[model samples]
Target: MSQQVGVVTFPGSNGDHDAWNAFANDLGVPTRMVDYRETDLDGIAVVVVPGGFSYGDYLRCGAIARFAPVMNAVREFAQRGGPVLGICNGFQVLTEAHLLPGALLRNESLRFHCDWIHVKVENRSFWTSDVEVGDILRLPIAHGDGSYFADDETIARLESNGQVIFRYCDANGAVLDNANPNGSRRAIAGIANEGRNVVGLMPHPERATDPLVGGADGRRIVTAALSALQVAV
Candidate 1:
């Protein structure tokens, strides 16, 4: 069975330790911090790219982090069917790496958002496997460029392929304009790659793992991924 999770840390990754705490400390799972300068992922079971303004968000969020030496290993790991989860800025990095499709533009409101939101599960893939479709997940999002955009063709493709994994929705799971916090297209908050192993989302799941912090819904996502990967804690 898979053993340890690897959390990648870029120059400005503020959430690396948060993620490490979630898996290693909170979840009681083993974890390692993968430095961006390192080009290897030797024994890592699952990979997580946490959030932050990598490379100072230079050029664009995740643009520079996409070229980090560690990302090359991540790409290779994905090619080997490894499960990879990217959160917030990590999501941006995956898109910039072409590991996923589309781009995240500035929020439609043009303001940074740091709020709790609801998302409905659209598919059972990788990081979202344990959640049933249409289930409402309450997670926190913190990003200035979380708006998801893609050409109509690409959007349609993702929709038809069931690549859309999470969509902004009301607390009761109703997808509506007001619930679309970042104005993401079709309210998409997360998605999976064609392989269904690479997943990225604009929410911060690691932060919600403990009750003291708020809710434990993010714990659901993490444990779900671990369960799906059959990685015992």
Candidate 2:
């Protein structure tokens, strides 16, 4: 059976449609756009919190969105071992929801960055099972607040637990020192929960699924989630 992925859209979400299209057409899967107000979590194989300025970035990147009914449902869904993927602002929401650790602070440059970035696979999280450690993928990142920050102990624990899923790399997939685009600690571009069911990243993999659109490495992520569903079944 085709896996059904849910693409969540908030009041100001701009990537909902794009995510749905990429997951559905490019990946040859089925997808749904879940409203932020809904609270039901039935029959969804995977949930994607697409990138956008939810609630105008009020209070914080995802503070307001965290209180949304859909997020509450999403939280419960994640706790049940459901696969949840968050991108850009969605990453902020996951952190705020406490599904994932760390916070996404404003870029060190304090600028709205938008461009293709190189990210290294640091661990074999569920969202990156198809990705090998040290492999590099090109994906676009468009956000102003994406610097990941956690206490020293938490950082050490995350690294030790193999939860750090991605790190920023250079053109040749070489890990750079302090070359982080957003001052993210340890160059973390993405991470996963200890359960490996919830994933959050600052890059837009959905936007990178098509080489015709600039890159195809993005498809690996969506495909990974699809693989998760099969594992569950």
Candidate 3:
């Protein structure tokens, strides 16, 4: 049976449809569009917080959305070891909600970045288990506040725990300053929780799942999540 995925839709979310298309249409998985006001997550095997300027990004990127009724359920779900993937602005929300470590600051360029970039898989997580370490993926990123930041001690902990799942890199998997799109510390692009079930990233993997749109590298992530959920069942 196909895994049932839930895609959260905040008031300002713009990537919910894209995520639904990727998982439901392209991957042939069942999907539910969850509203921010909903308080239940009964049948969801996996939850995806898609990218967008939630609450107009008023009081910090995800500060407002963190208090939504649905987020309480999301937090509880994640605490129970459920798989949760946050993309782009969704990543910011996860940080603000304290579901993940680190914060996302404005791009060093002080501008919105929307383009394709390469990211190297650094560790295995539910979202990255299908891809091998050092494998480079072509993914599109669109965000204004995508620079990942954390205290030195927290960074060290994340590194030591193998929680830094992906880092910005060149096609050859070389981490380079020029390849860093948002001046993220250590060129980090994505991370997972200690359990490796919760993940947050600044790139839009759902946007790169279809060949007609661009590349299909992102299919690996969606597929991996499905595989993990199946194995858990």
Q: Name the candidate that leads on TM-score.
A: 3
Error of 3 at 172 (Å): 1.1
Give the residue spans of candidate 2 off by over 4 A.
Answer: 1-3, 231-233
Against the true structure, whose lDDT is highest? 3
lDDT of 1 by residue, 1-233 (tens): 34789999999999999999999988887788999999888778889999999999999999999988898899999988889999999999999999999999999999999999999989878787667887888889999999999999999999999999999999998899999988999999999999999999999989999988988889878875566335533
Give me candidate 1's TM-score against the actual structure.
0.96
TM-score of 2: 0.96
Scored against the true structure, residue 81 in model 3 reaches a CA lDDT of 90
lDDT of 3 by residue, 118-188 (tens): 99999999898789998999999999999999999999999999999999998888999999999999999
**lDDT, model 2:** 0.89
Question: Which parts of model 1 have CA positions greater than 4 angstroms off?
Answer: 228-233
Each prediction's number of clashing residue pairs: 0, 0, 0
Better structure of 2 and 3 per lDDT: 3
Return the clash pairs for model 1, or none: none
lDDT of 3 at 158: 98
Number of the candidate with higher lDDT, 1 or 2: 1
